[model samples]
Target: MAHLIFSEDEQRELREAARAEFPGNPALAYVLENLAAEGIDLDRGRDWEDLRVEAGLPERNAEAPEVA
Candidate 1:
C-alpha cells in the first residue's frame, strides 16, 4: 500500500478548484475514489476534507448538494 501526503497550500488550492467546478461530474469523484482505494494519489493527497480546502471545494453538507 502507498501513502498520500499534501501541503497546506496544495490543500487550499484543491478545495477551491473542486467547489468552483462542483457537481464534481460524478465520474471524476468515482475516479478519485477508485484511486484512493488502490492507494493511488487522488487530488494529489488532498482527500475529501482537504480537497475542499485546497480546491476551494464547497463544504459538503449531508443535507446539501456536493460541490466537488
Candidate 2:
C-alpha cells in the first residue's frame, strides 16, 4: 500500500501555512513546486479538501474500531 505517513501536527502546520500563503494559482504552484524541490512528492489524486476537513480530527476518533 502506498499510504502516506505524515506526522499529524506537522502536516496540519504545513496545510495551514499553505492555505495562508498560497491563495492564488501561481502562488499555489510555487508552493507545490517548492515542496517537490525538497523531495516531498505528494499524490495529486488525494483530495485535500477532504483532508483539510479531517485535519483537525484525531486519527483515533474515527467510527471504525482502533487498530493496535
Candidate No. with top lDDT? 2
Quote the lDDT for 16 in model 1. 54
lDDT of 1 by residue, 1-68 (tens): 34665455665555555545656486675554444344444445545686669888677678896444
List RMSD in Å for every model shown.
13.5, 13.6
Q: For model 2, what is the alpha-carbon lDDT of residue 29?
A: 55
Give the runs in model 1 whose Cα sits over 4 Å from its true position: 23-68
lDDT by candidate, in order shown: 0.56, 0.59
TM-score of each: 0.33, 0.32
lDDT of 1: 0.56
State the displacement of the C-alpha of residue 19, model 1, in Å, after optimal TM-score superposition: 0.7
